[model samples]
Target: MNEGLKVFLAVADERSFTRAASKLHMTQPAVSQHIRSLELDLGAHLIERNNRMIRLTRAGEIVDRHARQIVQTEEQMRRLVHDLASTIFGALHIGASYSIGEYILPVMLADFSKKHPGVDPHIEIGNTHSIASMVASRTLDVGLVEGSYSPNEVETEVLGADELILVARNGHPLVRDSFVTIAEAEKECWIVREEGSGTREFSDRFLEDHHISPERTMTFSSTQAIKEAVRSGLGISVLSALTLQMELELGVLQQIRLEGLPITRQLFIVTQPSAFQPKVVSAFSDFAKEHFSDLTQTRTPVHRTSIDET
Candidate 1:
């Protein structure tokens, strides 16, 4: 029945037996046979036949809807069964934006692997917009992104809060003082994340709020590239302080507090609200919340500058 439904869907979508047969990698005779068997089982013709065109009958439309639901449910059932057997033993598909994926998730994933040796984790890294789209479309089991998502089909939870700081190479002119006003910060050249990045989105919103724009800016897709560029005195950038912890320790980069700028943003874990979540995903989500909660709680606040300081 599943196979029959698959064949039916292909034919219905293509509106041609020959095309459906090619798509399904089946002979035209086999495709026709499946449709015939389906009609026999239901005791009704499913497709309206014509020499040049094929259309779905009223019954076919209903069956097509049911077929899609059936397929989706079956896949969900398989995932659930695999999860129940031992969530720690299945593959977990996760997507994340560049900053979180590169700077934060590695430590979390490493800890997860050590704790759950049976679970295999595969990660896909992209921009926040792409990661959110993947989660909404069920292409990814889960995603970690910075900032908020507006997609109605996806559910989101805040994983942690991070501050974006204006950073520069050690001894750079911008680092002369512990704090600078937004107007002063905007006068410097900037190395910024590319568009569509959650980091970039937050940075843009913060700048717009302060009525300041960078005099010059260079865009980089990778945070590593941006960091290195800033280290080389190419320009300054606004980035999550967590990403620069090692750089700050090594004296490679210095954080510059900026007045009248809201540098804080939330990290989110997003997934399709209606999709069946595998147990592996559920367990990972729990682990992330537990570990990240402790980390965020114990962390000291970054250099704070009041908006009135400007």
Candidate 2:
């Protein structure tokens, strides 16, 4: 009944059979069959269906709670079995913010895979906020983010500090003097990362601190897109120094020093606090925490996590 429980949970959570089927990649009829089969096995109606609406019965509510726990427990059992046999095994789902996911994670993931070949990593890259949300919802086993997250919902540990840089195309007038005044910086067109981006958060803070408001602004969801826009002389942007290494080395883009600029952001590893932390997840988190400094090529102390603690 593993599939049945999963189907029920999806239906109950989505409150729409069509949406749940699309989410699970199953047919609408198949989803209905699973629910019907579940009700028959339990001898009770699980949900009340009216037209396009669905609501769980009292029995369904209890099953929903227990089913979630059962699914989590079953995954823990599988991972534990694999760990006892091979020390580590199974897929590890990891979420990361754009900068770390693109320029940082591949390096660490490569090394982690070399040492633990049995673990397959599935990575989803997004902004810091979204990544943290997924970790809290248990969709992602672990997350590497550059922004702040809720302390009450998820456990976090500082992985490292990422340096933010102000970048413009080479020969831009703003950097002619090797430094930009607040007034000069405010006059130029600014390109920023999309809403909810950690890089954008720092950029916004910088503008607020300097009291510099731009006359024009452009927003892009992708870091690379923003970089390209900056390169083509669309507008200057604030981005992670790690993402600018190649362009800086190539003389295509230059880092500009605004007075009291160059903000630093803390990188964090976020995980859901739970009683049972699979060996695979713990091992990967430990590995990433210890090796995060390599991303910045700095020697510094690392913090530890207590996610597995009861």
Among all candidates shown, the one with the greatest lDDT: 2
lDDT of 1 at 92: 72
CA lDDT, every prediction? 0.83, 0.85
lDDT of 2 by residue, 203-305 (tens): 9988898788998999999899999999999989888876777887787987776764567779999998987778899999899878976656753212121
Estimate candidate 2's alpha-carbon lDDT, on a 0 to 1 scale. 0.85
TM-score of 2: 0.77
Q: Tens digits of per-residue lDDT for model 1 on 1-310?
A: 3899989999998999999999989999999999999999999899998888899999999999898778656655766888767655666779999988998799999999998887778799999999999888766778999967785868899888887888889988778555676677778888888889999998888778878888888899999999999999888888887787788778889877777443778889897786557777788988887877877786545667775554
What TM-score would each prediction reach against the true structure? Answer: 0.73, 0.77
- The clash count of every prediction, one per candidate, is 0, 0
